[model samples]
Target: MTNPLPIPPVTLGAINMEAEDPQALAAFWAEVTGGTPAVSGDHVYMPAAHDGGFAMFFQPMTGPRPDRAASHLDLTVPWGSRVATVDRLLDRGATHLWDVLEEYEHVQWTTLADPEGNAFCVAEHPPVAGH
Candidate 1:
C-alpha cells in the first residue's frame, strides 16, 4: 500500500447545528430542500447528499431564547427564479424584512427572515453581463 499522507486523522465526519428546536428546524429544512430526517434519542439527525452532512444534532435549551451572534446562511436566485422563489419562501412562513430599490423601476434586493429570525436576502435584480 502507498504510504499514508502526513495530514492528521479526520476526527469529524459531520456537523450538527444546535437549534432551539431541532425537530422544527429539521422539518423546515427538510420541507424546503426535500431532505430526510433521522431521529435517535433526543437528537434530530439529518443527512444530505454532500459529505460532512451526515449529522446535525439538535439539543434542547431552557429559559429565555439564546443568542446566535453569527449563525446564518444565504441563498441565491441566479436570474429568472426571483419571483417564484420569493413567493415560495413567503408561503413557507418567511417574513418580509425590506425591499431594496435601485430605482422606481428596478429592485436590487428583497430581504426576508426565516421563522426563527435568521435573515437572508433574495436578489430581485441580477447583474448583467459585460458590465
Candidate 2:
C-alpha cells in the first residue's frame, strides 16, 4: 500500500463577491446568469441553473466598493456572436469596455462592466464538429 491514489477532480462550486447591497447585487447576477437567488443571513446565494453552472454568493461590504477587483468573470457565446452578446449586455445595463479581435481568428472577445462596475468578458467559441 505504498502507492497513493490521486485525488478526484474538483469542480468550481461557487464564487464570492462583495457588494454594497448583497441581495440586490445577487439578484442582478442571478438575472444575468439565469440562476436562482436566495437570501441567507448576511449574504445572498445564487444557485447554479445547470449542471456546469457555478453558484454565486454576494456578501455585504462595510465600506465603499473596491476601486479594482482582484479577478473578473468571463462569459462565452457561440462563435461569431460575441459582438451580439456584447450589444445585448450593453442594452441590459452593461458598459462596453473594449473589443479584443483580429482578422482570420475564429475566436474573439469583448470586455464589459456590470452596473456595479465589475469587469467581465464575453468570448466567442467555435462551433463543434457536428453542430
Candidate 3:
C-alpha cells in the first residue's frame, strides 16, 4: 500500500527544543556538537556541521517540561571515542543514564541527559566522510 500523492520537496530545517534557559542549553549543545551557537530574537540557533544539515534551535520554555520527551538526538562519534565523548559530556554537566554494549552485533552506545534533562545518545561508529 502506498500513497498516491507525490513526496513533498521539503527538508528538515531545524529541530526546536524548549529550554528553561536557551543560552545555557545552546552552550551545552555547542559543547556536544562543536557547533557555534548564535542568537536571533528569542531563539538560539546551533548550526549544523555541514551545509544542508538541520540546525538545532532552542527556545525559551513557557511551561512545565514534559515527563518524557517525544524524541531525542542520537549522535555518532568516531570509532573508539564513545567513552571519551561521554566523559566530556558528563564533565560538562550531563547525567549518565545507561550503556549498551552488545558483542553479538558489536553495537555500543551511551545514553545521557543534558543539564536540562533532555536525553540524547552517543554511539560509536566510523567517522562519516566530511562530517
Candidate 4:
C-alpha cells in the first residue's frame, strides 16, 4: 500500500486586535516589545520581536471595549522581573489590576490593562528542574 502524504505544520501568523486608535495602540506595543510597527491598507502591524513568534495586528474599532476574559496576552519576562516590569508598564499607561503573587498565592504574574483597557499579564516563570 502507498503511504499517505505527509501533513504540513500549521503555525500562527499574527494576532489581530481591535483598537480605538490602531496606530497608537500598535505604536505602544512596538515601543514596549521593541518591534517595528507599520501601516498597510486599513490595519497597523507590528512584526514579532522574537523568532517563531507571531506578529501583532491592530484594526480600527469603535464603541465600548469587549470583555477580555475570553482572550488575553501573557508576556513573560526574566525570572524575577515581574514586579519591575509591572511598574514599567504602569508608568507607560497601564492600569494595575492585581498582583497574582499576592492575590492567588501561587502565581508569579501581575495583571494589568493597557491604556485602551485591554487586559494582559506580565509573568515570571521559573525554569524547570530538568530540561
Candidate 5:
C-alpha cells in the first residue's frame, strides 16, 4: 500500500446553517442552545458555550430546503430527560418527526425539525469524553 499522507492539524470551528431569516433562526437556536446571538450584516452568529466549543452561524438562504437533509445535529441530554427535553423543544416551535426506542436495545432518540425545517435529534447518551 502507498504511504498515507500526514493528516492535517485542523479542528471544527462552527456549523453554518442557512435560513430564510437569519436573525429569527439565530434567535431560535439561541434559545435552544442557551447561547447569545449576535448579528453582523446579513449573518448571525451564536458563539459556543466556551472557547473551542461548538459554535453555530446562520446565513441567508438562497435555495429551498431539502426533503432529506444529508446531515443533522445530534444533541445529547442527561439520562431520563429525553422526553421532557423533546416536549420543551416542541413547545419552542420544533416539529416532532419520529422516534426510535424499540428499534435497538438501550438506544433511543427522537427526531425533530427546527422552525426552518432543519432536522436534528435529541437523545439520552453519555457525554463526550472531553468538553
Candidate 6:
C-alpha cells in the first residue's frame, strides 16, 4: 500500500483590521509591523510577511461599536506553550484587553488589544499528533 502525502504547512495570508480609517490604520500598522501596502479594487490592502507567524489586513469601518466583544480578532499560537510568546508580544506594545485568569476557572485565553483598540487573544493550540 502507498502512503499518503503529507499536508502542506498552513499560511496566513491576511486578517481584517476593521479600521475606522483604513488608510491611516494601514500606515500605523505598517510602521508597527513592517508591513507594506497591497492593492485591491479601490481598497488599499496592507501586506504582512507570511513567515512572521501571523497575518493582518485592513478594512475601513463606517462606524464604531457601542461596546466591546462585538469586535475582536482570533489568533492562533503554537501548541502547549504561550507564556514566553505572550510576554514577547506584551513587550511589543500589545496591552491586556481582558483577563479570564479567574472567572472561567481555566484561563482559556488572555484577550489583548493593539494601540488602535483592536482585540485579539493568546491561547494554547490544541494538540496535533501524528502529523
Best by TM-score: 5
- Top lDDT model: 3
Q: CA lDDT of each candidate? A: 0.64, 0.82, 0.88, 0.81, 0.86, 0.63
Q: Candidate 4 on 26-118: residue-level lDDT in tens?
A: 877876677899999778989988886569999988567666458888888888788887887778788998777755433589888887888
- RMSD of every candidate to native, in Å, equals 6.5, 2.9, 3.8, 3.4, 3.6, 7.0
Ranking by TM-score: 5, 2, 3, 4, 1, 6
Candidate 1 stretches with Cα past 4 Å from truth are: 1-16, 49-57, 62-68, 101-108, 123-131
Please list all clashing residue pairs in model 1, or write none if there are none: 16-56
After superposing candidate 2 on the true structure, give the runs of residues whose Cα lies further than 4 Å from its correct spot: 1-3, 62-64, 103-106, 128-131
Model 4: C-alpha RMSD to truth?
3.4
Can you give the lDDT of residue 116 in candidate 4?
A: 88
Superior candidate under lDDT, 2 versus 5: 5
Q: What are the TM-scores, per candidate, against the unseen true structure?
A: 0.60, 0.82, 0.82, 0.81, 0.83, 0.53
Lowest lDDT sum, 10 consecutive residues, model 1, at: 49-58
Write candidate 6's Cα lDDT for 1-131 as tens digits.
Answer: 77598879987677766666666666655654567877564356765645664456777665765575565565556654566656766776678766554455334577877656777777765555666
lDDT of 5 at 21: 93
Compute the lDDT of residue 11 as modeled in candidate 2. Answer: 88
lDDT of 3 by residue, 1-131 (tens): 99999999988787899999999999998888778899988789988857655689999998999998899988887789999999999999999999988852545899999999999999986556788
| Tens-digit per-residue lDDT, 1-131, candidate 1 | 77787878876454455567777867766654456878776677776635433444455554555555365454455666766877887898778887766654434667777677667677755566686
Pick by lDDT: 4 or 6, better one: 4
Error of 3 at 104 (Å): 5.4
- Residue 33 displacement (Å), model 5: 1.2
Query: Which is the better candidate, 3 or 4, if ranked by lDDT?
Result: 3
lDDT of 2 by residue, 70-111 (tens): 899988877877777677778777888988887436667888
